[model samples]
Target chain A: MAKYLSKLSKSTRSNLYTVTAILAAYIIFTVLIATGNMSNLLQGLLIQIFYYAILAISLNLTVGILGELSLGHAGFMCIGAFTSAFFSKCTVDIITITWIRFTIALIIGAISAAIFGAFIGFVVLRLRGDYLAIVTLAFGEIIKNVINVLYIGIDQSGFKFSVKDSVSLNLGEGGQAIMNGPQGIFGTPNDTNLTICVFLLILFYIIISNLVNSRSGRAIMAIRDNRIAAESIGINITKFKLLAFTISAAMAGVAGTLFSHNITILDSKKFGYNQSIMILVFVVLGGIGNIRGSIIAAAILTLLPEYLRFLENYRMLIYAVVLIIIMIINWNPTCIAWRKKYSIRNLLSAINKKKEA
Target chain B: MSFISYLIKGISLGSVYAIIALGYTMVYGIAKMLNFAHGDVIMVGGYILFTVMTSLGQSPILAVLASIVFCTLLGITIERIAYKPLRKASSLAVLITAIGVSYLLQNLALIIYGTETKFVTSVIPIPTIKLAGGNLAIPGQTLVTIPVCIVIMVSLTVFIRKSKTGRGMIAVSEDKGAAVLMGVNINKTIAITFAIGSALAAVASVLMFSSYPSLTPTSGAMPGIKAFVAAVFGGIGSIPGAMIGGILLGIIEILGRAYISSQLADAIVFLILILVLLIKPAGILGRKMNEKV
Candidate 1:
């Protein structure tokens, strides 16, 4: 009985939920691919599943765990996408080794996004609550517009930069244009696959869940749970906030690299206020502090729009209805009381007892 | 001359923005929530007005009244259904609920209005006012938007000053518990605040879409955000401050387009927000409050 109890408790550990969910998802995906059950549409959506999952997890760190709201995640993602897209585009011919270049792209993307994150975090992390949301949102918008008007090119003379028009890059005789203002980077690389995505997803899961259970993560949560109490205990609010924010930003950037490499042509419009808000929605709906909840929420919501495609224009209306209903069910007082009364733990224990009898 | 005309247009645009800002500022003042859906409510107004005017060929006044009524009802309904339950919930919870409401509204508009942009017919027939020997000309829409904004602002200020419900609202914002103990119906006051704010959004939406000559599902989003910035700029809860902030923001945005690269206007507006946040988090006209704990 004690052995059974210990095993039950090990499997039921809450942080391990992400592990369980990912494994289940991976198995389902593999089976679908093996049996050829996944349609092309769903296959395409798999990329979104991986990237959005990455985005939601990273956003959850700041919004759910760090007790801060950041609306600029898409901005970091944008920086990552552009950095890697340009890197890949410029080096596609220069670097003969495809795997090496992809690895370099990931490193460069992560570092670039982290640098931007550190810059933005330093400016905005001093503020508390809603102010952070607003600043991050503004940063996301600024980055989108900046990217639209920027131009980059590479040739024998190395990289050249201009704005407003790509023609102005004025690369040498054999220069190749990497980015055209507004048009974004066209004809980059499409290297994203379920295998890479799953591997990266696992890596992301390990990093985030570990951080959540770490000493630094505890201190960060202390600040969130009670700023004054945490301060009394001698936690440096600024350092931790910056650390969580920059790391979250770096992870989002890695997702961006994955996303950009997946798509043949990258458009700046995809990484905008709407995307940021959508990611935030995923975090919020995922029960804030629940890592597994974020993963599940991102997966479900990413597939929802496509699932409702049969409804066509009305799908969005249905989407809104679903949002309101979910909040009502999850946040309603009566529902909360009912859930507590019929708690999962009690139900599980009852089943165990019945089995023993 | 074109520059001067842009300035005038900017002011008119700012006037419309002011009316919208009034909605956000008042709601924040009383409800103590950012009311993220206030912008989406403006879209609702535009769609309603667009449908009524285009479908029924109703008189402009009728269209306007319909919009106002629809938004008022919407504001109340949103408060009762989504927000009332979460009144005691955490700030993040309330914020999420507010966003859900926003998504609900935008998606609803998308369903009903379709993905296409609907051209909004002008309600006001005033001719373009030419000045500077015809080098500068202001559209007739400006005439209606600016004057209407002034009239609304003045009336709102007066109503808040003398009216009983207005006083009740003031008391509630000042201190919710005290207001309730003093015989103010907290729910009613909150409802009325929402009604008035949403009514104001109706006017702003009509002006916004009509000026741009088109109404899309996302017609109100940018303007809505800009107006919120205006509300914040003016010291979120201050009526007069919202006015100043809206007008200044409109001018800066327009001039930014005229002089600086048009693409960077949003960046500039956001930069100003950050600078203001860094320098004065409470905003220019906002009274600073010490943190309680």
Candidate 2:
């Protein structure tokens, strides 16, 4: 078995490994779903894992690769969710006529978010490091507050208009009311299926992985390593940064669409400052610049609390402790250096030297 | 109350922001880090005071002092554990670390305090004082906040300008390498800066809680970001500039809410930031530093 594994080409081996992993995951999910005893709690947890994984990977494009700290990625997500929600609301037969309207909503959401990302990038991309982070943070907060106040629902008396209108839409009786003020938009269509979400996620993962391995990704890495040397080599920092930001925003929009449709409830609070920080946490905890690490981290973080259900009220505390431990381990240079110093190659060479002696 | 009364209110609120902004500016000036966790530290201080005030049943002044001490220790510890190690790393790394620490702190608070809003009773008696024009009422809390802010600001200015340690801080902010060559203790100075800055944030927290009296885990997020904006608006490294910028921002926000649509108030502040950046990227009081090629 070992000889056969070693004989396989690197790409073939990796592809086989990925296929096996996916099959295993699918089998496990199917078993869990089929089991009558498992609660909706597990199902909800799995969905959240998939959702946050998309968000973390999207954010990692800018933060981990481009080496820019953006506090406004959530704003892009907000734009995407709201855009898709708006369209889904307008069309009644959303689930059946999915192909055309879904594509349009997704495109529109991506384009709008990308446009906003580009505009913000042009303005604040000049500032690097901490300055850029603060500006972006403020930008995110401003976007959230603006969305909060902008009335986007149909009113009663058959009047559908914005908050600027004189007559307000009275979402009568039931919770099926129009986007309530500050309460957030409700009754969005839950058209997101697991298959579609998984397919898109895998597609994004491949694209991002490829991009990070390409020449442009190398240029971004170079800039991240040493700005002066990269600039001296004639790399256009601003252009590349803007590209990363726009792409990241586009991906975030996709995630937003998935999120809005999956939950069927959209609120301003869902895309607030905390959500932005949460994405950042996932990226960092998963090992920055490591896409697989981010994916694994997102899945684990989303599922860990669910698994530790007995902790109950102390769940967050346990999560915090685990995070602190992980951070300490990651940040400790001595441990990393030691591992590098005493690798299998070193052990093999040392054994050979002793045998020769 | 007259417009002047409104002006006073603005100034008072701005004074609090200025105090908070000073912490941001000074730390950034020296470390060149955004300290995303700084505002959360302020929130932690407020929570500390709330705990002390509620548990010990102590007087307001004593509770405030205890909270400052608690926050000062927290600030120093955070610097040592999270930031000090990343000092040599890229500025972005430090910022990420700051964010992580912030999340850690906020979640810790959430775990400890739960997500409920804690109400704080006023420490100082509410005093209604008449002013010129129609009758302007001033809360005793506001009076205390203003004087305390002035005293701290004045003392900070003096410390930075006059004392040797303060001069060492200035030198370090100006040039870390050169300061080290000149026999400055870089770590000590940095730690001192964090202590002072955290203490100022503690003061801001106490004042804010005194006036508003409600505290929650996420409370620090907005004020922290706004204070950072104030720091930027007034030229990040300049103290007096932060003071002016904070007051100006406060007035703009309040007046914008009163006159214009309440919905557009936040937008207006952001527009101001954009306009300021376009017009004067260095900020109102900030001197443009030439980038080294």
Write candidate 1's Cα lDDT for A41-155 as tens digits: 9989988888898899899999888989887899999999999988888788889888889889988889999999999999988766656677788889899999999888878
Off by over 4 Å in 1: A1-17, A342-357
Name the best candidate (by TM-score): 1
Q: Each candidate's root-mean-square deviation in Å?
A: 2.8, 3.7
lDDT of 1 at B265: 91
Give the per-residue lDDT digits (tens) of candidate 1, residues B1-293: 88888898899999988999999999889988878889888889988888888988998889889999999999999999988877766666677778778877887788676789888777776889887788889999998888998999999999999999999989999999999999999999999999999999998888887788688777778888889888888788999989988998899899998899899998898888888877877777987776655
Chain A TM-score (model 1): 0.91
- DockQ of predicted model 2: 0.41
Give model 1's TM-score versus the native structure. Answer: 0.94
lDDT of each: 0.86, 0.78
User: Which candidate has the top score in lDDT?
Assistant: 1
Model 2: which docking level applies? acceptable
Candidate 2, residue A335: the lDDT equals: 46
